[model samples]
Target chain A: MADPQGSNTRHQAYFRANLTLIGILLVIWAFVAFGCGIFLAPWLNQWRLPGTGYPLGFWFAQQGAIYVFVILIFVYVILMNRIDRRYGVDEKD
Target chain B: MTVQGWTFLIVGLSFTLYIAIAIITRARSTRDFYVAAKEVHPVANGMATAADWMSAASFIGMAGIISFLGADGAVYLMGWTGGYVLLALLLAPYLRKFGRFTVPDFIGDRYEARTARLVAVVCAIFISFTYVSGQMRGVGIVFSRFLEVDIALGVVIGMALVFFYAVLGGMKGITYTQVAQYCVLIFAFLVPAIFLSLMFADTALPQLGLGRLGDDGQSLLQRLDGLSTELGFGAYTEYGGSLINIAAITAALMLGTAGLPHVIIRFYTVRKVRDARSSAGWALLFIAILYTTAPAIAVFSRTNLLESVPETAYVESPEWLKTWEDVGLIAWDDRNGDGIITYAPGAAFAGKPIYAKDPETNEPLRGEFGQRLITNDSAGDHNELYVDRDIMVLANPEIAGLPDWVTALVAAGGLAAALSTAAGLLLVISSAVSHDLLKGAIMPNISEKRELLAARIAAGGAVVIAGLIGIWPPDYVAAIVAFAFGLAASSFFPAIVMGIFSTRMNGPGAISGMIAGIVFTTAYIIWFKFYDPSSNTPENWWFGISPEGIGVIGMLINFGVAIPVAALTRAPSPAIRTLVQDIRVPGDT
Candidate 1:
């Protein structure tokens, strides 16, 4: 095991990186799910999809947000995995 | 074959598959019973989680509810699915790394108090039972309508089937059966959707079909808006409620989803922390297949119902209408006495449709148009037909003139959805009782074999109680579902989040926060939902946030109370701080 002092500093850096990543992703998460989907839905409704002619906000609320949620989780997985490796905390293969 | 015959065969085969899988993978020890021996691959666990999480409400009720609500339905569509993001990022991996069998185990250990564990145990059991009863009722509803059986008998049959696999296999049996159920339900949900999409939108994908123009030269949603407005209902795509309520309700549901014991327990079945993260993604992917399609189904069914039922002679109404009417879920009053159905915006009669019964044979009294006669007076609205929101999904196949087997498949799918969720909830309830309550507190020295037996007994007993609740459900059952989510949101979500992210969170602070959260949320819900339902409207609400959304405030109360309380009180021990740090990283360091 590494010395306690160095390990503690490494741990702090790792956690801060993880926290920063989470904060950024969550902002995007909130933006799509709450912002485009609900709050600004009426404003977005002024625009329609190119071919199908569905209101942009309506589509996001009912369909787009859900698709984005799935993507967000997978993105977190990928980024968190890389961070884990950088911090020497990824699950041993 | 007749719908009933096909329903019996398909539902029978599904049950047989579940039982066979259960017997093969039956739990042999406590670990197997609680966490499927932690060997389930992420994809398989994902499918199981999908089925377990999407209860009968999502399968049978969601589209119907959405059809009625129009754009406002996004609250449920977004609320339910968005929670997975919270689960993956804020909770699941860390919980899996903690490696406990039940949610209470984590809460109990993290807070370092028996009271905290007991509180969690109560919330887990309370929330699960509240939700499970609704699933049982869904099973009974599907059974009565499709299989031509009594609702009580349907609940009993559903109970018996769940009992076999759940008691025999525990989490192991439940996990595999849920995967099978996910397949059945998704296939059943998709076939009719694809057929309808093809017929209406000329697109094979329901998601795309929803956006495209129909034969009427309007997008399906536009057409729905026009049709609803013509009939005096609000336009289909406009939401009239306050935005704050919508946001609050969505937040409540999302946090509640992350907090649920049954859902949290699913992560523990995965082998590694990363598996928990990815499996959540997979679960949402599977769920989205249905969720994205449901709005399409909602539009198709609503448009079909409006075109076929209204402005038509009662005698010429489609076969599904008559069929559903016989089950008393659909009714017409002929208020204008024109022999024509008028399905406008208002209730046809006051209260539910109470069929006039023949005292001797117990058959419904019929009107001149051969419609089931009702005893209630007019609701004074122009509407003549009473359509239950549930029929939007249940009778969609028949409404669209699909073959009888397709209808039967829908029945089987609804049963699978209900039974899968019921089995999952029962496992959570049983594990809480046997693992957390009994072994952890009452008898720490109990043998693994005896604990396994206890788990089985707990599950079996829970099934009977759930069935009883289904058969003679209390008036508060529906109200309690809202409470379940709110309670989970206000109680478990804050406590667990704090326990993981905030190392300074001590037993006293967490305990007080939990109590404050649950008490505040509960009192608000009970006051509005039960005690003073007359004042449940927005104007009477606190800051225009409905009781359905009050849990958001309760969650804030938890956070607001917890941090200060923790700062004032002694911090957690250094070892406990290390535990928090350990769970954050996936590998040993």
Candidate 2:
């Protein structure tokens, strides 16, 4: 029944960290999808990639963005687990 | 058996199997009904989630959208799948550890306010209904084309199937059935894609085959670009829209996927937080099988379609064109009675080319009567050939002259995909009404038995409404569904993340944020989607973001509003803080 004010501070820190990670991830996601896929597509098109006729940006927009997304999920899981443990809120069976 | 009989038998059998499974696995208790007694295996849960997430839109509409959009179609493939990564990393496991039956339960409990839960209920209903309407419409469209049934009758049949299991068996039943659906849908999607790839590129793997250019030794994309350019359309691989718009739309689709309630609720069905995390990874893997192949399906189908009918006169068009036309999918009009098909850009076809004269003697300029098959009728005259984008995937096997059974299988798969998602969304709506609204808000002391009854009633009622919408869908099923994503991202995602991770996000702040976000996003969509003049123009957009991309902006506003409000508001009670801490630490539970 003790006041959980101190724990609230800990929770707040965890929340902040999670939000920061989400923000970073979101920015990178936008960069890949919008930057490589659309905005920079013309610039990236100058360098011809081997095998495929598509420019680098076109590949990233269609295929690379998805690959990056899969990697991001794994990164989130690893980071969040550490965050959970650090906050002493790790789930136990 | 004939293709039609085979399709009916296979699809009917799958439906029968689904009902049998639902009956056998009907939940015995309220918890069992709502969250599968929280015992779903990570892999199984992942498969079920894939089925739940891939609706009629994914199966029927997505590839078609990609076919017309060309290289840009990658947006759907990447955006939809990438959201799972966001879900896995940013949301799922922690939410599961928070241990709630529905998404609103977590919001209400975390914020320590019934009002927050109610706000969540509104967002949930709005998002689910928008998404469900599209699925119902997809079902009707697919049935009308393949089964030759009336669209309204098709929607009713789909509604009845969803209502039967969703009301009777609840989450436990839905989870198991979805796993079966995932298998059926993936098989249905891949078999045709692979067959078409083989026909087009001599490679059975659709992904690699798509890269192979046709027999002229040109890359597939190069050939497609040439064909499209020849046909008076934009290049297949070229960018079309403003960079900002593309970026915004992609972001909206990704964030919206992360925000969807039905998707988030599936994670709660697992036994532990770890399972939720693992389940998301597995779900992405399952989804990737079809997601990766979808682009290839688009490429191969497009290549085959063009090659089969390019420059051919109406009388000489391929058999598949006539077949698809009978289904009202492909249409053509020979505006001029030129015995040959002419495909070229509008400007190139202004007048008859002086082909009768020698090239060395004749100038490039020509008279009004060109040898071109198309006329520049100022009204954006119809092309002699018109193909509905939705048919790209569904009609792919038939287009490539694959075996009859493969075509039938694709039909069954589309139904499975549509039905699974419809069931999942229906459950969300019903649970929100019965559990959150009835038991939690209106009748706090209601018995479990009474609550279950209410849940069933809600599920049945939702199916009927969704079916009605499906039969007579609004003109903007895709746009409305996009709006649903915006609402989910704006309202639920921010509140849930804050509630779990931020102890200071009190009831008042969370509730206010949810209300603000939902209201703003909904109003924005309504205004632009329904009210605004020149509604489709990007210039008419708010802050240069189209209605499609506004969801991401709305999410930021929700977080912006909620965090500051929480700082100014009084802290939550000690008891509520303890509950928050308790939910975060599974060992304490």
Candidate 3:
């Protein structure tokens, strides 16, 4: 059975931690996808990666951002798993 | 063997592999049919999801669009991939924790309303159909090229294959088959891109090769941009459309991707909520292999096109171009005996006008879609060529002179991508009809056997409808998929998001919000797509809001309406609020 009272301190802490982590990761997503990819593409284009010869923004748009997104998801997974374990909400054996 | 023979052999072998997998993993129960017994390994499920998510548009059409549309094509790159961010952060793990067989099931349980479930089923079916139509058409196009059959016949063959797996094994068979499909499609897509990259840029990696300097001391992008400007087109490397439109379209596609019932269902198939999170990551990595590679392929192919196809030598054009041209994709008005082909954007009357004369001047102008009426010696008469954009990816290997076996492999790859997505979508539509609609609403006591029967039958119906759509494809098969994404974004995305995050949200709010979003987005898309196709241009669009991006506006409207409506209505019961809490936490059970 579950606790009748909702919003326990543990629940609140877990929620806050989860939201904070999500907020941070999403900000990173916005930065890479919209910032480097679109808004700053022109400014970044002035600088090219040495061997690749791609403008910074264009590379971010085409490739860099995707790599970041994959990394971000994994980070979220690791972080959440930790928080889940801390709060005793993780999958039990 | 001939290229056609190679294609037949490769496509035949792929289908046989999928069928064999289907036989091995037959579904015995509804759970097995719907969620593959909830036993798929995260990495394997990730691979399957990548195949399931990448439809014909991803395989056959994305590179073509990127080639023609240039830098603006990043909307697809970011939009299709970025949605996984939202999937990972906001939706996937929570939904997996809820542990449902379908997306609508989640909505049904969360909202605890029959009406909400029904509306969700409707949205799922609608989105899936629009999605599957584009895929079936993609299958037909590939078939028409590879099999030397009519487009309709190609679609039928694709349909038969989809029906075979989806109806028999449901998710159980389709999951394993999709894993096979991911391998086939990726290999098919990479070979040509890699070969072209090596030949032109002296780089082995196509992604890096795209950014490398061509042998001519000019970056491929620089050369493509220069050629585009000279040809009166937008630069390939710059944002061609309004920034707002680009952002909006990308956001809509991303949200729509997250909202897609078929994609969301993939998360539910994993063993644990944690796998759901990791699987989405793996899926993105799998997809990135193709997504990142597509832009490079686009630039490579476009560069090849401008260099290889000489307007004058077009009649004796390379075997690949001739083959594509034979398929009615390339057309020419050889008014002069020069045998050259020209495709200028506007008003280059090469030699004569037949029927399509200038409205005011009565002088014949040249264009493929509209024919001219008068015969006149025009200066630009020497060359007029029409190459269909859809053929760009297919013809890239041939254009770059890759071996015939590579081209044959491409056909197999395109089919695998299309068939995998088509099957995934068909299952979603069938489950929406069978599990959500028939059993949930219309017949609650329906046995598992009866429900499975309904599921199979509904899938057959869905395949037939999708085949019909393929036979009579929309004006642009690729763009039509945006409508599906847009619909998902506008309706399902909001409903599911609010249902999970907003505890106070009531059924009426959810239902009304979805209805409003659907109506607004659907009306906008229909108005622009069919009723006023010309008005789809940005100049006339409201705030430069093309129908593709209107989903963002629709989603906002949904949030706006639902929040206010929920505030005004009675708050949900404590039990319902607790359920929301249960979902928000990782281990609900």
Model 2 global lDDT (CA atoms, 0 to 1): 0.78
Per-residue lDDT for B320-430 in model 3, tens only?
Answer: 665664455665555554556555554334322334457799654644333222343455533355556678888887888777789999999999999999999999998
Per-candidate TM-score against the hidden true structure:
0.98, 0.89, 0.92
- List the lowest-lDDT window of 10 residues for candidate 1 chain B: B213-222
Better of 1 and 3 by lDDT: 1
In candidate 3 the C-alpha lDDT for residue B35 amounts to 94
Residue B567 accuracy (lDDT) in model 2: 88
Chain A TM-scores for all candidates read 0.93, 0.88, 0.88
| lDDT (Cα, 0-100) at B274 in candidate 2 | 71
Best by TM-score: 1
Per-residue accuracy of model 2 over B283-392 as CA lDDT, tens digit each: 98888788877777777777676676767766766777667655555544345556545443332222222123335865323223332122233224534455667878
Residue B560, model 1: Cα distance from true site in angstroms = 1.0
Query: Of the pair 2 and 3, which is ahead by DockQ?
Result: 3
Judged by whole-model lDDT over C-alpha atoms, candidate 1 comes out at 0.91
Which pairs clash in the backbone of model 1? none
B17: Cα error in model 3, Å: 0.7
Reference-based lDDT, residue A45, model 1: 86
Q: Model 3, residue B156: what's the lDDT?
A: 92
lDDT of each: 0.91, 0.78, 0.84
